[model samples]
Target: MSEQLAIHGGKRSVPESFVKPWPYVTTADQQAVMEVFKSDGIIEQQRIQSEGLAKEWAEYMGVKYCIPVNSGTAALHMSLTGVGIEPGDEVIVPAFTFWASAAAVLHHNAIPVFLDIDPETYCIDSDLIEAKISERTKAIMPVHIHGMPADMDAVLEIAKKHNLKVIEDVAQAHGARYKERLCGSMGDAAGYSTQASKTLSSGCQGGLFTTNDEIVYERASLLQYFGEIIVPGQEREDQKYNAYGLGWMYRGDMFSQAFIRSQLKRLDKNNSLRIRNCNFLTEHLSQIRGLKTPYVPNECEPVYYNYVVGFKPEEIDLNVSPRTLRDKVQKAMKAEGVSMGLWQRLPVPKQEVFQNRIGYGKGCPWKCHDSIIEYKKDDYPKTVEFIDSHSYIFDVNPPNDLELMGMYVEAFQKVMGNLDRLLK
Candidate 1:
């Protein structure tokens, strides 16, 4: 009786090319990048633009300092160094987040102590953090996964109690907030990514590091530019060639910086659009029996970097694994022209890097430290369950409005409404 499913030669709910690509580049973005090319002092102009963006981002984030970097990974590593994360120190992180959240700790020779996430929020479970704290615990890195801000108040309380630092990984949460406070501003130092697919895209790879502590800022600044005290806008005239310590070439490029500057002007507006679109999807999708819409906490405002949906086969009396049902639904939805896919298939601790204890060559950090901590994948049951059941719906941002959102709802209805046919 239901309309035939798309995979079974039925009419597609969303027409081909109905959903547009991400980032929604504008004419102003092009002009800004072009302006950099036309400048007489290319490097000088680049530095000016890069520093200008840092200032703007720091103001927007309500933080005291911002460092522009080449990538989010670099930003996180700089933050780790800024927080005095010495070798063998353990940094507690959520197991369900992107691997970079843990990899950044390894970059500093610090062991990442993976913890389980809150099943509802998909952020680190603040209640479980204290159990993981130890004598070697240096900091707690909580990733704002999918732009949903972590429980920063609880995290800060735990950090204060344990006398530890909190480094927020705001890579997926550019404009998100927890209890009216910005995600990056609440932490000792936070890292953000301006990668092309991110909410605050730079049209390519870029990153920002923010901190309220002057000491952390100065330390991170040293690590960002090859350990030298090369002041911005000084043209390296006051630069001392002496290497204060080990550092990396983590500077942002001129073109990406210019594009980010142009993009920052619209970040809030774009985030509003994303919030609208995601809210609409949640409203409609939540009505479907087997599909679970994202759960937003009362105290947080997320930017919806990814609109995550969970498959609840048990709710629908389906005698199948959640992953099996999810795979079938995802395929059927794709046939209906819906953009949905999984982000992380495995938990962070389950990844080969951690499973094999591979840290740099020869397991140096793990071996060099000679610590007895173990990374068992089964320790994070919630993260494994979440990954097996949920997938992200992409393009839920600006340049793709309510009409596209309506089509997405229609696609979900058509595909999930006829799951019997889809499974057959």
Candidate 2:
């Protein structure tokens, strides 16, 4: 085993910079899309391709229904709305997550009662949920953060006991599995992001919602299409503009649908490469002092959306703080052409938008306050510690050509060699 040298305080070379300009979209995939575009069948009728792709995705997710939408946020909003999350209702969410997770809650006029995350999975702490549950607690939205599965057993148990709904935010985890069940199929309903940076991007923006419940599926489908109710036996003259329920225009575009369908065929192949690269990095980096790789629970088959690493303050020999160490290493790696940067900042409670309500702020949800009696930063100690100590390393999508993997491996090793000096 080759050991990495500590280069705590040194400038990086231009070539050593992390190198993922854009996600890997295959030429063959593009060609297939181009062929679709050229065909009269595609140009003539867009709905056929969209419907076909939705069916294909449904099969892929092992769910009864899959509705493709414009974006992941839209999918989340629809899922929440479809399941009856109304104004003033409180949705328990993990504070340590992307803004979209909470944003979806707020969009529905419901309040987001932020909860703490499990430090290992960086997901909602299911154990802490009972303490926050109240009469007003309508749902629990658990995000599969950075591809690691949350403890679904615990989360489900709490939900069952409390009679609360479970909505899985699977934007960061496509093809991820929890206890042999696919992620999108785990909860009452789930949302998937096919954004450009996600594991299963469509070369553009799109999202998917999956559910087995017929009522939930039907309501969600109508919600995505502006709530237009097609009556069982009535033929409407102006069908395009009619609506029967409250909804929005969150339909998926034809081009994005076609592109994603092509990409879906190779998702497993791409995920396998990510797994291999992540395992390699973990095996090598674990030997470095002061560094802690992500923890994978026994039940999870994670898809490695982003490879997160933590630098414990107590473990480091350097005088610099964890934040300073992160900055220095990121700067050096950038100089070396590597794109290393922190992914998430402080928790949601600390953010100005949530805490201060600068532009359009609402006070914390009533249910949260009533349940905990007083929501305080001190309450979620582990969540705060994880945010402060962690920095994210993006796991590049598997290159269209597997040969590029060697270059990536070499670059990572070189970056590791300069770590000690970068820290200084």
Candidate 3:
């Protein structure tokens, strides 16, 4: 007989406070932040940490230039602008990703053309890129969602054929690789987030922008510092107060940059642990009927930023929608102490901002640019289905370890074994 669920006054499968917190902050991480405070002047500190992090990250990503910014959205916006995405231009983006992927397009007054993701990878469908390329399309922004690298080869090929620039959204894929090449290195420009929850954390909000083109770097640099060509650590008399072009105060703080630098050192190690834990989960959980594990491609090495699980009602002979079954399973699993949650509830195109076209007020971009593109929610069936059926397992990173993962598997087994009780 299956053990009674904790939801019904039974002992919890996972003990209270068993799962460890993320980012795995250590004594060394603490020291790195403290070092920033020891610097003499604010300007000197900012220059040292910001420039150092840029150099370190640029070298890591095998890119020529990197700019540290305040947030991932800022980095993304800079990437689009760096690649010469002008106002009224159109940029193709995946409908399944975080809204920021598309929001960055609109920040520059460009239109975001949303496309459905591949059911398998949950990333943009490279096979569908050609159909969305219009005369006004200036770029294609392929997001490496949930630490999984998108099909870069096919995306690059299409971009080359159509003469469109590629901007990679590496917000969730810090150490992920495709065909042994790093994710951010293959695109014209890329954006990465070092936000607190991400694989490579800054302990707070932060972002990195990287590209090989000098012109693109220069353009992006201007946007980071109030559109000025001001040099960090330069003499006060030499400061340039001129605004070369429109810009935002997207510069990152010294504290966050230092923390990010410290974290970057262990990114590979953390990613490896995440891979091991996720692999273990898949090995055990794949045996459970009606549960679908993530589908990794042969050419990609994912870091498992999120361990996404899909619930298939049909496989278990459940006469309920996947969403309904997913919610019930999630509730029962929570009672057993498994940490799981849904990230996106709807496709990006179905978001109210797009549905009402309330972009920048009065449908500015659509009205101002006279864009003919429509954001019908039905266009992205795969994204809708994925969102309705799946939930992510959190804290799969290091410091949590395989032991906790084993407990998670036990919890799943217990819950699934007693689905009859769960349905009641």
* CA lDDT scores, all candidates in order: 0.90, 0.74, 0.92
Candidate 3 lDDT over residue span 102-210, tens digit each: 9999999999999999999999999899999999999999999999999999999999999999999999999899999999999999999888999989888999999
lDDT of 2 by residue, 1-424 (tens): 2234223233433334335444676787787678677888764435656677779989998888788888998888877876778877889999888888888877776777888888888999888899888788889999998988878989888889888889999999998899988887878888899998888887789899888887887788778877886432233453666676878888888877878888888888888888877777677667766678888888999988987877754575667677666566555445444445777677876676665533234354433233243346676777778877777666446662233334434444565555654454
Ranked candidates (lDDT, high to low): 3, 1, 2
lDDT of 1: 0.90
Ten-residue region with minimum lDDT total, candidate 3: 229-238
At residue 75, give the lDDT of candidate 1. Answer: 96
Per-prediction backbone clash count: 0, 20, 0
Q: Point out where model 3 deviates above 4 Å.
A: 232-237
Better of 1 and 2 by TM-score: 1
State the lDDT at 403 in candidate 2: 35
Clashing pairs in 3: none
Which whole-number lDDT from 0 to 100 does residue 213 have in model 3?
98
